[model samples]
Target: MSAQRKLSSIGGGQKTHQFVDDSNRFEELMRLGHSDVQIRVVKYGEESSGRRPLVILNSIDFPMPPSEQFCDRMWRARFRVVFIERPGFGTSTPLPGVLLQSETIRNGAASMAEAAILQEVFRRLALEDFVLLGMGSANSVCYRLAMICPMVALAIFSNAVFNQNILDVFRPNWFQAMLRQTIQSRAGLQIASFGVKYRLRRNPEGFYGQVLQKSAGDLGYLQNNLADFERGAELFQGIEAQTIEYDLNMSLKPDSLLKDGLFETTNAVAFSGLETTDHWKSQLNQEAKRLSIDVEYAPNGDLYAPYASPEFLLKVITDRLNRLGAAQSG
Candidate 1:
């Protein structure tokens, strides 16, 4: 790992978060245009010439730490794993003002601008030619990045969200509108932030349990990994709530790519669990058909598998990477 990168508070009077860790995983805040983005980067095993670096873009609201065991597996497989907290989450600076635009065309342009921010992040880090992994709504941005950026050679989506319907189904239109309003209103944002902190603190178990139940994952896992889960939540301290809201709002929009040549320029994979809704599965299959990409299904895992069952998620990614390695060697 590179030398520890120093972090400073972004705005005057804003609270700062200190992230010192024993695992040698470094977290840094870097300026990107008018916003500051937080990135957590870790490398396992030896850096070999044979494998490509892997970048994992987590969900908008989750700044969850990368799975250590999964990272170890990637190392043994010859890949370096990087977990990044997207803007408006963790310690990353959020865009100023209400992000909801007046028109659909303008919303699409905003989505493109967000993808461009990822490109800028790569340039700032001097990173290139890496495989991109995105989970849930984050995959939407990854798809856009892989389509437009030459350095993204492979794009992987796990329990990917491809349409506005997914978000609408998960949370009704009225609820989303309420969230948008709370995120934009200062007093509302503080109250909402306080509610999040209170639940995560007072009922971390019940809190994470509700999340795990969505996929029917084992809640016992959360019990066993309580400390890790708490640590991951700690990373969210002092993060900009508006950024999380921004991504959430953006996620409710349609896919960023034109349907014609979705994954044409990049090798793609969809890793999902058996419990995924039939409608989502059908949509994913259709998108995969369009891109000529296969969906790799894990028998007992679901959308939140990466957090709930890291081993299952790791296997899915490794299987694809192994196939690519074999084909290249042949």
Candidate 2:
């Protein structure tokens, strides 16, 4: 919530977005949870517009002040987007020692409770049809949110990691004192920035270049993404203690949500990276099929496939939204 990118009109009724940096919602929510935390939100599109908004709950790693590419896409599609930085990360307060008590992954869904707050924000603006989308790291929280808050219209996921028995991938001991030390350290921030910049420069195509290839008919779409990563130091500024913990606590459980009937959601669309682990998706496909919902793998992609397959991602989302929308209409 430190800074924001306001809307840039691309002509016609299509409009870019304006973000209210330093949203107070986080502060308010912190009081309610008794969890000393900070949260920042990047509001997109014209909030006043009577459009069905898209609330993108980003992965724990990447925070708000969204990529212009995402904004441009949302703008053109006539959808409003808001990316919020979870507590103890980004501009929010540091993670309290008590955070040391949760399932590590349970902290992942702490924001599920935040849904009530976000709902109030949306309502004040009258953006009634708000659909939720979650990226790789976000799928966990999104799952719980969709489960706990059944009022949500649809849950669209990108590279959902739950199909993997997260417990198999991570463990409590993984939250070693060393990792926590790094997250709270100055060196960790610099390291994260340099690391991302290095990756983007090395594979702009894989990082974000692959996303727009099918739609633009040219490789030029990557230029902006490349630039963002090129200035990775700035694009990835601010550290979130929660994000740091989320990464280290790899084995934390994210599927207990099923017992609560959250996954009973009849409307869900998932697009996963074919190159990534197929298990969580394998599980999702089975579950979706059993529930009569659709789960499809990207024609050809990886964990970052959502970026690589934005068009396909949109189609999946639009399809799910259509079904969910039709249900509401009926």
Candidate 3:
């Protein structure tokens, strides 16, 4: 994604900046004796460590390389960026090999543990008052984080919804169907992260065409993202006869508590793309309004629009934060 295409490593170190968001601003955080199971983290600028700063979790397993290509400009601005890889994907280890935790207990524990570790990222980094950006799948993670962590200053969610609220004509059932296929095909999903190879699986030409398009067609952003999500265990359903399990067996506990508990300290901004389903567009507006957070819209597709329209988002967020600043000052 970098114009360089191939970046020589700065040192024979893990901290090379291949395509860091705000490329000039980030350095890979050394393991520092922490378990590798802890997700990878990179600071936005060459700042002293031990600051909390704004912690951002990309949706699900989205790669920093590509996101950097698309949205690095935005990430470089306003706030320091902290990128986290969720458990089961990216640099984070999928629950310990030992299944002693049980599917349910382990799932719940991991999310909490992940949140707790994130707080550590803040404390260890020495920054205070965090912000969150959960695009697509990460929206759920952000939602969970807001409920679990009181220190989060703001939460930004894009192209993500709960419980299939938007089943509009703009939606793509076949896209999810493909995920179902990937979930079912043990061989298919393991290689999802492989990108080009996975693109060739069904239609190489068409897939690559979409990637270069920078936005999805009528199928929209979610479809393109589902396509881009180059990683995951073979769709669990791909391995099993049943359909994909939307089990947030890990999510229900925290999410339930969030729904029940009154959320304070954290403010929010919900963004949706016009190309998205009417249901998605409406649902996000209503929810954000109800939650008392600001809501914004993008004319672009779901995936890249948050990225594509970063300027617009920044304006909305900046204006809101300024008002917030004024209220505090007064």
Q: Number of the top candidate by TM-score?
A: 1
TM-score of each: 0.73, 0.62, 0.65
- Please provide, for model 2 over 245-291, each residue's C-alpha lDDT reduced to its tens digit, 9 standing for 90 to 100: 45434323335544433355445666665544345556656655544
Native RMSD of candidate 3 (Å): 7.1
**Residue range 114-177, candidate 3, lDDT tens digits:** 5566655555545566667776655655666776666776677766554344423222343344
- Mark the regions of model 3 whose C-alpha exceeds 4 Å error after superposition: 1-34, 48-54, 65-72, 75-78, 97-109, 167-172, 179-255, 258-265, 289-292
Off by over 4 Å in 2: 1-38, 64-66, 100-127, 166-224, 230-237, 240-243, 247-254, 259-262, 275-293, 299-301, 328-330
* Candidate 1: tens digits of C-alpha lDDT, residues 1-330: 443444444433222233435554445555554434444434333333456677888775456545565566665666777666665555555444454343432356555666787787776555577778787768767777877887876777877755525543333343444455553565665666666667677766666666555355535446655766686566556566555445554555455464755655467777777655676678767767766667877655464555555566566666766776788799
Every candidate's lDDT: 0.60, 0.50, 0.48
The predictions' CA RMSDs to the true structure, in order, are 5.6, 8.8, 7.1
Residue 309, candidate 3: C-alpha displacement in angstroms: 0.7
**Residue 175 of candidate 2: its Cα lDDT?**
26
